[model samples]
Target: MIRHRDIWRALDTLAERSGLSTSGLARKAGLDATAFNRSKRLTGDGTPRWPSTESLAKVLNATGVSMAEFVALMGEGNAQALGQRIPVIGYAQAGESGYFDDAGMPVGTGWDEVLFPAIGDPNAYALEITGDSMAPAYRDGTVIVVAPNQDIRRHDRVVAKTVEGEVMAKELNRRSARRVELVSINRDHDDRVLAPEELAWMARIVWASQ
Candidate 1:
């Protein structure tokens, strides 16, 4: 799993490679000069505060750094490091408060954590499968890593949470300005098409611990 320090290390590396300082890098990315300052790396409570996806996107664009290369700059692997983890929760439990914020990013410390592979997105999380809704493709006990910042395209498997707190994993059969058509993995389950207003946020499924 990518740890907090890993992210900071990557940003610093990006600045060094660009012949600039952290503040300079942030400025080039159209962010405040102190955005990447060490003092701003943590919150008042000392908890780690990761760079937002929007900010990271800007930095990558400004530096011409591909997501793959940026992830590589995070240094060596830490999956073997005991207790180093990322947020995870059961599928049904996601509807409950405190697990996810309004943007569908994991928030609060109530979630269970597990070591997962690097996926480019700092806010990536895992969801344990719970029922037959996405069986065959993803049955009960399967743990899927979700990349909220990953690009979504046709035929990509995705996890979508609705405004009513309903979450479903489905294939992106088609997406348009007004409707999102999803194909269910289980033949027994009917395909679904949701209106733009029905979806709160939809993220791509990057990995499955099958």
Candidate 2:
């Protein structure tokens, strides 16, 4: 049965999964912040007020969440509604070898994984890229999913680790005997060359939903 409560529940679940309140979700969707407020869910005469399709679509797009997943979230119990806990590590710490335990498990706290997308591989990790350093292509606050096992090729966007313990995302230009040539997506940023010894690890950018 299609009930107004179901729709409300779905929105609530989405808010929780995204770590945002109902009003926050609405604002993120470019809607009036009060659009999803509980008081706005009903009319003065007690008629159920449902969100417009446009509003719902906006929320889905903003959250990078698919419709199928949204529906599934709505159907789940409150405990399950909190979303799956995946390893959430900062972009700066991604290159640290021991940040993840020997078993490839994430260690420490300040990690909150929400339901954004299902990275099929258990070893897959995500890093929320900050700043416009790689912009004109990748904007600030873009979340990039890195697949360590994925093959990296020339000209591909990659997240590479340096022996100095720094991690940065740049387009792979070419690899030579002495160094690697990397291009910056944002022309404002200069390209870089790293000596062989400076490179520790590199992974191709599997997906970026920004």
Candidate 3:
């Protein structure tokens, strides 16, 4: 007895779990960009249109979600999928004392909380963007989830803190024993490289609410 609305909502949940929009999810599944769009959910005659089983199966495969998990998202089991909470702080306050540890993991008090799909990292946290400094890519008020223990790789967006207590969100270009090269998220800023000794720590940004 799966309702049409339930199926649609399950798709929305899957998109959110993967940090993507409905169109993005459709593209990832190799379907038409409007496959999961609301306009396509109703016929021209105003009749409710249901998603095909084939499309659902393809989405599940592309997102690495099992059919059981998709069904769970449509039912009371949805709670189990989105209940993980992480400490949150304003990006502007990230450099303040008592907000982070030496390793750049969030610690201490004054942190708010935000619920997200399970990221499986106890050291994960969220940062609320406060200004247009990271515009276009991450606008003001966007919530980005950071994974401190995740491996930082080339071309990944990251939150980095320097030993002098400045926090920056940039894209990693290269990293070596001596220095790390980073490209600014905002095009107005110039690319820079800093000695490894100048940075306190760095963490990968895993997800962002855009």
- For each candidate in turn, the TM-score is 0.60, 0.56, 0.69
Identify the candidate with maximal lDDT.
Answer: 3
What tens-digit string does per-residue lDDT give for candidate 2 at 1-210?
345786789899899989999999999999999999999999999998988756876798799885447756656553344333355567777767777553334467677664533434556666887778877666777666676666678998887777667777899999888999888788887888998677777777765645
Q: Model 1, poorest ten-residue lDDT window?
A: 76-85
lDDT of 2: 0.73
Q: How well does candidate 1 score on lDDT at residue 82?
A: 20
Report RMSD (Å) for each prediction in the order shown: 13.4, 10.2, 10.1
Cα lDDT for residue 152, model 3?
86
Return the lDDT, model 2, position 116: 35
Alpha-carbon shift of residue 176 in model 2 (angstroms): 4.0
lDDT by residue for model 1 (1-210), tens: 567998899899999999999999999999999999999999999999999866886797789875556766777543343222568887887777667887889887767776544556888888989976687778787778898988999999999988888888889999999999999878888888999789888999876654
In angstroms, the error of model 1 at 199 is 0.4
Candidate 1 error regions (>4 Å): 1-84
The Cα error of candidate 1 at residue 51, in Å, is: 30
